[model samples]
Each structure stands twice: as C-alpha cells, then as structure tokens.
Target: MQPTEQPTKTESLKVAVVGTGYVGMGTAVMLASLGHQVVGIDIDQNKIEMLRRGELPIYEPGLEDLLRASQERLRWTGDYASAIPDADVIFICVGTPPLPSGQPNLRYVAEAAQSVARNLNGKLQVVVNKSTVPVGTGDWVSRILEDHALDYSAGRYVVVSNPEFLREGTALHDSLYPDRIVLGSSSPEGIERLRQLYQPLLEQTFTPPEGMPRPANYTLPELVTTSLSSAEMIKYAANAFLALKISFANEIAGLCECVDADIEQVTHGIGCDQRIGHRFLSAGAGWGGSCFGKDTAALINTGSEYGYTMPILRAAVEVNQRQRHLVISKLQRHLHRLQGKRVAVLGMAFKPNTDDLRDAPAHDCIARLMDLGAKVTVHDPVAMPHARREWAHLTYDEAPTAEAALRGADAVILMTEWDEYRALDWDQAVRTMRRRLIIDTRNVLQQLPQHSTVEQVGRTTLHNVPGNEVLAEALA
Candidate 1:
C-alpha cells in the first residue's frame, strides 16, 4: 500500500469538521486523504494551534503521520464563521461526556449546532452527527439549526445522524477501513450526500496509506441507511454489546477462579463456537476508554427514559465496576494489610498504544490502594504524561521505566497490557522488588521468575518461593 501525495479530483467535496478531538481529528484527516478539502474547527485554541502547526493534540497510532501526509488538503481553525459557510458537509464531532445521571451532557453538541447554525451561508449543507449522541439528537439539532440559522425558509441545511464507531488507539485505521457506514435522516438527499462523500471508503478505491495497508480479503464497508433514531441507536448498541462481552468474560472469569478453571482457556474454547466469535473476550482489568462504559450507561439511561428497564446492560456496568475493585481485593488477600506497603503499578492507560486515561481501571485501583495506606508508584510507556496531570494531586510516584517502578516495591501490579510491560525482565524484577510478590492482572506475563510468588486473576496462584507455602496456606 502506498500513500497518496496529491488530492484526487474525483468529486471532491469541501468538508468542515467541528471539534478536533479523536473522532473529529480522524474524520478530518481521513476525508482529506480521500481527496476532500477539510477544515477542522475547534473551540480550544491550544488544540487548534497545535493542529495548525502539524502537531496532534491527542495520541493515536499513525494519526499524526497520516495528518502530515494529508496536510495540503486539511486545515485547522478556531472560527466557525470561516470554516462552515462554504462547506458541502459539516460533521459535528464534539464530545458528549457523561453526566452524573448517566445521560450524556450534550452541551458541546448543542453549542456546535448553534454555532454552525449562525454560520450557515444560504448554501445547502448536510450537517452530520458524527458524535455518539442520544437518540432524537439528530432531530433536536435540526430544530436548533432551524430556530437559529438565518433563512430557514431557503432550505439551508438538512441534519443527518452519521455516528462514528472509531476506537481511540486504532481510530485512524477504523476510519479508513470501517466495518460499516451508517447514515440516518428523514432527508434522502442528506443521506445521499454523505454516501457520496464516503464513496471512496465504501468502494475501497483509494490507495491504502503506507503504514496502514488494507487487510487481505477485507470486504468493503456496508452502508446502512436508516431513520434518524435508529442510526443513533446503532452506535450505542454496538458499544454496549462490546462492553457486555468484556464484562461477561470477567463475570465468568470470577467463576473460573473458584472452580479451578483457567479463564484464558475457557474463553478460548467458547470463542471458537462460531456463535460467539473471539473478540473483546480477554478477561483483564476490565474495559475503560471514552466509549464502552459511557455508552453502556447511556443506553441504560435511554431505556429508563422510555420506562423500560435494561437489566442486562445494568449488570454489565456493575460487573465492570466490580472488576476494577478486584485488584484491591487481591492485594489485600495476598499482602494481609496494605498499610505502609510499597506497590509498583505497571501500565496506567486503560489499554495499550494510546495515552487515554478516561475511566481507566488503574485509577480506581490506585485510589483504593492509597486509601488503604499503601505507597504507590506507576509507569506506562505512553500514558505517563497524561497520568501525571490527572493524578498530580494524588500522592503517587511516577516511574520513568517499568524497572524503576518495580524497585523497592512490596508488590508489582500489572494494570495495563502494554507490550513493554509484557516484555519486562521478570528475573530482574523479582530481584529488584522488596517483596517477591507479583500480581498479573492482565495475564500478560508468559513466564515467571524462579523462587517468586505470582498471583493471576481467574487463575491459581503460583508459589515458587520455598517459604511462600505459608502464604498459600493463608489464602487457602
């Protein structure tokens, strides 16, 4: 696969992307690479300035490279008046952070809609809902534009729900090669315009970028057109289902531990059944990111709004929360008491390859460990900078290397499954730690050091040290 240097003039549409976060940034870069002229608009001056200087505000693999590759066709701005007027399509990629009641705070979306409305320049614009919003938000945005925008009688805009399904770490690849493209609106014209805009992706006609090659035997993305509400529901449903899968694995993993069965083997066996394919089944420190947990809660809240109780989704949420606490429980059981204990934590990011720490299991575990009077040190290959910012007030040491975090620690806990953590020298780690105790939460370590005690979630404890038999007897 080779990257394209020049824009292809095949029906290039002028596009404006509002809110240059993960979804917005990826969308803007992808559209430009697909030959559309894209302008990324954001309220954050820092982010806009950074992007304008050919730097990405957020961390995602291959995103900055792809953004640089497609720089000629892409531009970033802080003003809506300059970006939205001449665009053929506008994507609302703003944040919808969860409120205390589990409902998404649509303030950013509302603000973006209002701003886009004020900037409407009488040209027909297909406004897209690229953010994961509650059902009926598409209609709400349309109404907001109708009430606020000038010349409503002139048919200046039509709203469409085009919810993005991009994951944080692999967002750019997901955008370039999506499983499907869903567009929802009452206006057939609005749906058709988006279809045209995504035609290259839908047909897989564009040359694949250098680093991200198209998977062999990969099928073209399915384009699903539906009513506005259904399209919005699809994004929520997909995320909720994936969350359920992970939570379900963790729930069963708890049972596996009790029954002397290995969760890793169990999930592998059931995953081959064809009915339940293998994906998101790895039982670890549960799931955390911008999507799964928030989306599941939103789905449950949406159900409650209509007087329907979604028990399954509620259970998934409960399971995930409980799973994070399991780390604390394991620590307490093995170490007896956490007071005055020095613990080293590896991997602070929710998962690997990105610096996103939103709702990460590591934060909850670290907080509990702190409350229990244990000294904590943390390390991650990429998330350290963000973690330092998020956890500065909380008294915890930040280690530059995994070995530094392991030094002089009573117990080492594997929180995130970064490859760097997976490739640690266990023998040296055992020698460096004050206590020879290791907690493999993610089941990442393939082997353990000789004469060391290792505890894994959903598996039997390994007591390789001679005197550790007493500790095993205590656990028994």
Candidate 2:
C-alpha cells in the first residue's frame, strides 16, 4: 500500500540492532532518531567503545551528527544478553563476507541468530533479516532460531526479511528517504509491526535533522510487502543489475578508445533515451567497494546451487576485472617500461567521500605498478589512515597531500574522483613532475594541462613518446 497523504504517527518501539558496521550503525541511528529506543549490539569491543564515546568507526556523511542528536535514545554494548532480551524488534545486520567458492559465509549470521534466540524473553518479538543473504536464508534463519530458542512458537516470534539497499557513502540519506521499503514475512502481524515502525519514514512525518534537509522534489516512499524469498531476491537482483550497468559502460568505453570516440559524450547521448538512466553509466576505473563485488559473486553462487549458469553476470565481472588491468596497459603505452619510474596514485578508497578500500580498483592498479618495478606513492583525503593500517605490507609511499603525491612523479593516475583532486592546480603539478604525464582514469579533469601528455580512456589523447612529435602535433 502507498503511504498516507498526510503524516502518520507511530508508537515508539524498543529496537536492537546486531553488528555496528555500516548497515547496523545507520539503522540504529535512524530508528533512534524516529523516537525508538535502540541498543546497538556488536561483538567487537572496540567498535562498541567508540560508539559509546561518541566516535564513529566508519566514515559516512552526516551519520556522526545524527548519532549525536539521538544519543539520548541510543545505546551501544558488546553483550547481546543485555540488548536482546527486552527488544521488541531485533535486526540482524552482520557481515556476510564471501568464501573462495563465491558463496557467502553465514557463520556470523548463524551465531547472531543463536545468541538472539537464547536470550528471548518469551514475549512476541519480530526478528528482521537486514543483512544481504542468499535467497533461502530467511527460512534457514527461522530453522536456527526454532532449534535454539526456549518455548519457540509462532505466538512468541516471527522472522522477517527486510534487506537494505544502502550505498556506502550516502547510506544515512538513502535510509531516511528511500524510494521504497520492502518487507517480507509469512506472518501478517510481523509485516504490520514493521510498517508501524517505519511509518515516520514512509510518511515523511519526522522533522528533518539539521544539515540534512529533504530534497525539494522529494515524495513519500512506498511500502512494499512480499513473501520472504522475494524480498531476499530483490536485494541481489538490484545490486547485480547495477553491476551490469557499470560493466556495460566499461565495455563500451573500450570500444570507444579503439574508434576515437568519447565515452562521456556517448553515455550522455544514450542516457537521454529514458529507457536507460544516466546513473552508473560513467566509464572509468570500474566499480569497487563491499557491496557490488560481494553481491554479484553471491548471486552467481546461488545460480550454481540450482544447476543454472549466469553468463551475463559472469561477463560483467570479467569486464570489471579487465578495467583494472587497462590502467596498467595505458601507462605502459605512454612510458614503455615502468621500471624505476616515480608514479603517483591520487585516490585509494574504492570511491569518494569514504575510507573503504575493499576491492578498490586502485589496489589492483598500485599492485601492478609496484610489481612492474615502479616506485608508487598514493594519496586520498580520508583513506590514507585506513590504507596505512590495512595495506602496510605493500611497499608504497603515502603522500600527506595531493600536491605532495604529485611532486617529482613521472606519471599520475587519478583513481578516485574527489573534489580536492578535481580542483588540483594542474599548472603547479606540471612544473614539479619529472615528466608531464597523466592517466585520467576517472575522466574528472576539466581541461587537459598544456604541454602534458594525458591519456583518457574512450577519448582521443595526446602521446608524448619520443619520436611521436608528428603524431602529437597532428592531434593538437
């Protein structure tokens, strides 16, 4: 059903969220802001301690401010017993990292469920599956709870699938004003309870938090209720489709490079067709982060269990991997051999406005460059600290600033499109570099720096290789 024409009021609920990572943290804060009493439960003591001290373990826009505003209604703890017993609603938001077989390892989800089951207060409680799990996971979780919980029965508990569709950087905004909220459960009572819990969000009744105003054209979000399996499939299908769109753009960009066409212009032209939206169509270093790679792999693994093959999804993955190598190949074409060359990488986080480095394209690019005997230095506005801790085993210099990273470099690779990188003083950069070369993988530069050899994928670029002056002159 659609949201009401006027704002609807909902009674506050006692909510407990398991796992204090991205989804869990955001959900806990959102619910608390809606006047619900929320306790964020995580096994990680450090994360719990940080949350209690008004510090955030991860980087997400506007989350810290929201958490601070809702501190009175929110609590953080490492002990599940303290948080789970009195909760009217329990959300399982744990991680499902993939295994070597492409299947999601559900050990954490299983553990969390068992813990919640053992602590149940014998009162009616709605257990929600908010983690992105395989299609049949809702039933599996139900079985686990039944096998462990005391006096477990339909009257005492219900399992609901409520998968999240949050992006890493803009997670909080997406949660508060999502386009739709999908709830799946066999019990009508469970769906009604969640609908009441999300009434403020669905009806846009809650006052907007400071520094996070609602969009001008915003409308109330729809509430979609489905069977447990359909809700699980929705999350995987949505992510796989987005991954496919990015891979499609990259594949087209490769062809654009061959035929002297510009991907920026091509995407813009095609995006106007209405059938294909403009989002996720920009071609550059292919997508990276936790969700796209993990979700796509898990979706493919699900197909294999039923003896089905996903050729299109498999091709999309291959295309994404190829984009990473394309960066190395482009550098080699310009400089011939990378041995002893001073190369600087501009962004390390998989994407801008975040400190997440999982499966980032820059990782593959830096590794290949270092292996080719090139000296590599990397810089990101907020990711350097996390990179130092996670990627310390790799031998690479960490530049304190973008300018510092560019100094004396033979070539520069723009990996992530940060505002600071986009607004860089290219004139100053050209003067300090040993060789004026840039590989604009993100296509973010406004104008190409004069007298510099810049190679951009899917666009005609100048080559400054020795004895290619005639070709350079013609292109200019």
Candidate 3:
C-alpha cells in the first residue's frame, strides 16, 4: 500500500495514545480537537472515567475545556487490546521514572509495547514513543515487539521516537503551536506514515486560536529520519541543556550573595548577548519538574554506561541539591535555631500553574527544617491535598489562600514561584504573623515592604541581629 497520502485537516485518522498522564492526556485532547479520532487508553479505570465525562485527571489551565469540546472525537478506555488494534498510529506516553540508582526503568514502555504487539493481528501500525526514554529505546521497543509475536519485519510495525516537550500548565497550547515537531524514524515507510499522522498540524489547517498568529506552512522536513540511537539522544540533550542553564543561573546567584552584586542585574546584562539568550536565567529554588532532573540524570548515567563522565551535568545536579540547603541556611541565620521555630512554607508544588509536586524542593527544605526541630505549616493553591498525603506529619491549612497559612507563623519561606504567592498582601501577612520574618527563596517579592522584615537568599543581608550570638543566647 502506497503510504496513505498526507491527510488534509478535515481528513481524520484513528490515533491511540496509551497512558493518560499529563503528556498522554494533553496529546489526546489536542489531536482530537484537531479532527483526528483519538482513543486514550490507560490501566487506571478512574482516570478513564474522568476523561469520559470531560473531566481532566490532572490540573491544567486550558485542558478541561478543550477535552469537553473535543468529546465527540475523543474516547477513553482501560482496555488496551480494544484501542491498539484499530489505531493507525499508537503513541506510548507512559512514565519512565528513575530508579534509586538513577537509571530509567523502562518497565512501562516494555509492557506497553508487548501489549500492542500481542494485539497486532496483521495490520500496519506505527508505534511512536512519546515518553522520554534512554538512548536506543526505540530499538528496544522494536525488539520487544518482535519477541512477542510471529516473524514481523520493520514494514508491518514501525517504531518512531517522538519525544514530547509540553509544559505542565500550558500543555494543550504548546501542542497546538509546538516550537517544532520532531519525528525520528529510520524506515522510509515509517517516516512517511508518521508524517501523514502529523500532517494536519504541519499544514496549519486546524483552527488557529483567537489572537494567535496562524502558523505558516513550512514544508515538513523529511520527518528528521535518523538512527534510533540519535533520536533518543536528541531528547536528553535538549533537556540537559535547559537544566544546565537553570543551574548556571543559581550558581551565579550564589556569587551575587558573596560579593553583594545583584544576580538579576547580572543575568539581565549577560542575557542581552543573543548567543546566551535569557530563557531559564531567573535564579530561584532550582528546577524540580518531572523532566529536567530525571532526563539530565539519565544522560549522566548513559555516559557512565559508555565509560564517559558528564562533569558539568553532574555539577548542575549538585548545585540544584545545594539550592534547597541555601534556603535552610538563610532560615537558620534568622531564627538562630530551627528547633521550636514555626516556619510557614508558602508553596508545596515545584513551580506553579500545575498541581504536580514530584521532587519539589519544598519537600527537601521542609524535611531538613523538621529534622532540625522546626514546626512546619504548609499551604499551596492546588497542591495541598498532595502535600498532605506526601508529608503527613506536617500541618495543613484548609484555606486556599496564603494568609491563612501565614497566621501565627514565626517565618514564611517562599519555595514555589506561584503567581498567587507573588501577589500576596505583604503588610497583612506581616501583621498576622508572630515574627515579621520571611525567606524569599524565589526572589519574587519585587520590593520588600519597609514596615516588614524580609531576607532573600543570595540577595539580602542577615545583619542587625547577632551573627551566632542569637543562637549562643538561645543555647545559654
């Protein structure tokens, strides 16, 4: 069969996206909204039912409305067999979480591939690995499929490595207007088939969002055909570079503290250089999303496998780990002793806009403070429930607002850079708290109020009180 001609925007193809987590759900909703019939399969029945009712299993800004509108073209199922056989293209978006030793466990991907292979009776199907896997994962998936079934060459079943780069909050928007779509496949037929799958997106035929520029039709670049190994490397390299930028800024922030130089101004001056663009230069409590840490570490481990060392990448990881300690040190300076000091943590989620709290620096900060004997009360706009479940020993505030968490607190530490916390009424919170002390880890307070006291890591001075005299006095 001549590879099906690249379909027009109106022409829809059957697409199956396995795993209904953030990446999978966003992909399914976006493709369905673009006119393709999408079946989102997951083992979790609860998640499937939630998606069936147009409810998003995760908290994303514009996802629920898009899912609701695209309900006609989208379906959710817990049964993988029912979804995989009819799918012209199957996207595996399952998690590839890191083990304790920092190696990616590809158990989910292997299982998904085996399931797809078992159900493939004799139809042509393109399997796209949307999850960020280690190098040569596409070949591993192909091998697993071959082992599961009768003799099948690369023609009947094609595995493509197409990594996703959607941010948690703006996943749908990013999908609709991707910076670029990368399709990594060696087989000519596989490349052509995947191109046809994403042709609607490339042709700019989907309805453009209001006030957004219509995407120009750029001739699709031959699907970026390459060996499976190179394709896997592309995903890791991109994320590692971004993570490196963030760590570099934080390291500069430390320098700013030592020399009393403003890191923000320094970043602004350096960012003007076009070669060093100002993307992830904002210094804060470091990156704690699902992608950067895991992908970067996987890259480092992959280096170990090849008998090479990623010294800079390893330093990036160390700098990120020390960032949380920097916040704790600032707190220690203020209270003199963490024991018996009430620390109100302002945010629990990693960054903002979404409810995911995986590997949040706030957890590290809280645990350290607790170990030092600080009473912790935490609050988040949407992540309170998750935090409560994760850190059950800590106190939780029912009020969704920040002030409620600040009430009766000795000091407040801003961990996550949430917009709501940035817009907090400083004066009111200061009046309510026992001590007017704050450790703005995110450097988001804009201007410190004159009536209140505030100290930012790598910015403010911890003077006026005894350096270690306060702690000595407490001990005496």
Candidate 4:
C-alpha cells in the first residue's frame, strides 16, 4: 500500500460523515459551514437524494437554510466506497437504538466501521465515533478496523470518540453554538487531528449562518479532552443526570399533588440554590426522546452486566415512566368512569418542534386512557403522520386546526410543549368541547382560561378535591 499524506492543522481537510440522521446531518452541515469539505454518506438513497435536492428529510429549525448554504461545501452520497477512502476524518454518527436488553444495537455502527475499513485508502484518517454507544466502543471500532482493513498498515488511521450532545428541536443550534466539545482518543495524533477538526467550533471562529445567528455574548465552548471510555461514559452520564433531575422533580411534583403544595414554587426554590442551577428542573409529563430513556437504560444494563446495579438510573427510568400515568390518574379522578368517554391528547410528539415520536410520553398516557375504554384522539402540529404509523388505532385530527381535534371532546391533555399549542385560541376552542376541561402537563398556559376548568402538572390546585380540602388549607 502506498503511503498517504496527512493533513496539516491549518488545512481544510476532507471530512466524511456516515449516516444522515439528526446527529450526522447536523454535524456534516456544521463542519461544511466551518469551511471543511464534507461528504455525507447514508444507506438510504432517498434521504441522500432529498439532501441533494436541498430538501431536508428531518425537521430542525433553520437546518434547511443551513443545508442550502452548505451545499457548496457539502455533498450527499449513498456510497461509502467513494466517501470513506479519501476523507481525512470520518465521523460515525449512526443510530445506536437500544435492544430488548437495553444494550445498544451497534449493527449500524459496526457495519459503518467495517465498510470504512474495507474502503481504507491508507490515509491517516481519524475515525471518530459520534454515536452515543456503550463505553469502550472506540477500542471496539479500532479492533474491527484492524480485522477488516485492506491496507494492513499501522499508523494509517486512529479511532476517536466524539459523542454528540444535540437535542432534537434545537439540534442545528446546539451543533453550531455548542456548550462544549468532547474528543476522546489515546493517540495524540488522532486526538490532535480531531481537535483540529473541531477547533473552529471550539474557538467560535466561523461567521454565523443566516438563519442560525450566534449569541451576542456567546463564549467559545469548553473543550473536554479525555480518554475514549470517559467520552463515551460522559454522554451517558450527562443524559442520565439530566433525566434524573427531571424525574426527581416529577417525584416531588407527585408529592406536591398529595400534599397540595405548589410544585412550581418548590422547583423554583430548588433551582434558586447556586449549586443546583436552574436547567432541566421543570416538572412536566416526563423526559422522552431518542436519548434519555435509551441511554439511561443502557447505562443501567451496562452496569448490571459488570456485576453492578445502578439504582439511581433505574429509579429515574421508573419515575419518568410513572410520570406519564400520573396524567391518566388525573383523568380518572376528573372523570371517574372513562368507559365511552371522549378524550383528546394535545401534542403527540415527545417534545415540541420535532416529529420524533420514539418513546414519547403520549404513547404511554394515551394507551392507559384507551385501556380504560376512553376513546383517545391525538393532535400534533407535525407528528401526525409518524404518530398514525405508530398508533394506527387511535383517532387523529387530520385537519390543520387543533379545533378539529378538540371538537366536542370530554377532556384535553397537553403533552408536548409546542408553540402551536401555546398560540391556540382557547376562547373559541372551549366552546366546541363536550366538557371544557384541560390537563396541562407542559405548564405552558399559566393563566386560567375562561369557561374552562384546567389542571396543570405543577400548580397548587389538585384535581377532584373534596369539599373541605382547598389548596391553601392542604398546603398549610
């Protein structure tokens, strides 16, 4: 095999990103915007074609415009043979969905690594694992590469772990204006190469794209350079801690419901402490999405596999799952016999701004309501198609208006905190409902609606109270 030249730190090197999922696409665009030539490869030819046509398959705010702007520097292809061999850096941002046993299904990641190895052109490319996988996956990919490498040359390539910390709705924003950049590798050269790749982002040197503007006081994100295992574990541990905070808040919210203390005030008091900080403390439906549940379960499962049990993560998962049913509990108390009752759950997507319905709280809540024989109708501004595919049995409001879903409904539960829901004209919508009742899980609508009885998650007023049990008296 002929020796290939490596890139200098100042050079705009060729970059290849595998899998065009949320993480992959965002990373590719962000890198291209930073002046690196990026070739985004995916197995799905349709997705690649969509990207080629300047049509973004997934929905993230300002991602379409950013993709359009990056077209000059970024190319989309379905062929790994062409994309992998020439790149100076390869980011494996494929999906690592959890298995039945809570271990990550690394089939996609393994396939990507094997193919990258098979297409090795003796380049000193750094293969960075951006997928949130179990700890030690960097070494795992390194071994797989050695087994499948056609060149059989040492020092030609190195594996690094660079886990992504992107939220779904604000993925593009998160990638562009990151809080921190984490790179994990043992090899100094590999680490240096990856660092060079992310140096622009770490330094906040790039001009902001049109739709994605930089914050006025935006500081360059802290760069955390560490071992492969620590990087891998950081992604899991960070997500677990956030999920734990949310679940703990909900647990307190449940106690608040019992004792009639205002959970909003409680969480506010908790957030007032300088040590706790004020983020992820909102008491709401529950934490859901691609990361939280899957990663926490994987962390717990990984610990169990090594003869250690993670009670905190396990309890976090339990609390999040139970938080969904609490909505059902409220519904049961509100309307005792759910049999033949009409119910509508507003906002079907896990969180607002994205159509990703994987492990959404609406799934568990609506299922419980339906199990109690209540006819459940669901509404979401964007997730209807995906929701229909996931829950085909449930009635969906095909119309563009939320009123179509709320018309003559027994009760409405706000699950996802969507802008559309917050902007709704409840004045007229309440007139169409059979009973003007709302179970607001997201805490978006603060004021009392006219001609409606509303029960929010964290507020002082508990639902279905007896005559003598007022909120203030119970709190006292």
Best-fitting candidate, measured by lDDT? 2
Better candidate number, 1 or 3, judged by TM-score: 1
Candidate 4: segments with Cα more than 4 A from true spot = 1-10, 393-399, 462-476
On TM-score, the candidate that comes out on top is 2
User: Which ranges in model 3 have alpha carbons more than 4 Å from their true place?
Assistant: 1-10, 209-223, 393-399, 462-476
lDDT string, candidate 1, 1-476, tens digits: 23233534469999999988878888999999999999999888999889889998878999988889999999888988899889999999999999999999999999999999998988779999999999999999999998999777435599999988887788888988888999998888888899889988887778889989887767878899999999999999999999999999999999988998888888989999999989989898899998998899898898899999999999999999898888888877789899999999998888888898988898988888889999999998998888778877677898989999999999999998888877888888779888888888998866667677787877777777555655454344
Instruction: Order candidates by TM-score, high to low.
Output: 2, 1, 4, 3
Candidate 1, which segments miss by more than 4 Å at Cα? 1-9, 465-476
Q: lDDT tens string, model 2, 278-334? A: 999989989999889999999998898999999999999999999999999999988
* Candidate 3 per-residue lDDT over residues 87-121, each given as its tens digit: 88899999999997789989999988888888775
**Where does the lowest 10-residue lDDT sum fall in candidate 2?**
467-476
lDDT of 4 by residue, 1-476 (tens): 11113322445889999999888988998899888999999989999989999998787888888888889999999888989888999999999999999899999999999999998888688899999999988999999999999875667789899888998999888988888889888889998898788777776667778867777677778889899999999999999999999999998888887786788788888899999977899998999989999999899988998999888888888898888888887777778899999888888888888988888888888778867888877778888877767778754345456788888799989999898888888877878999978988987775445566677776654333334344335334
Clash counts for all predictions: 0, 0, 0, 0
Global lDDT scores for all candidate models: 0.88, 0.90, 0.80, 0.84
lDDT score for residue 121 of model 3: 58
Q: What is the C-alpha RMSD of each candidate to the true structure, in Å?
A: 3.6, 2.8, 5.9, 5.2
Each prediction's TM-score against the native?
A: 0.95, 0.96, 0.91, 0.93
In Å, residue 363's CA in model 2 sits off its true spot by: 0.8
* Residue 464 displacement in candidate 1 (angstroms): 3.2
Clashing pairs in 1: none
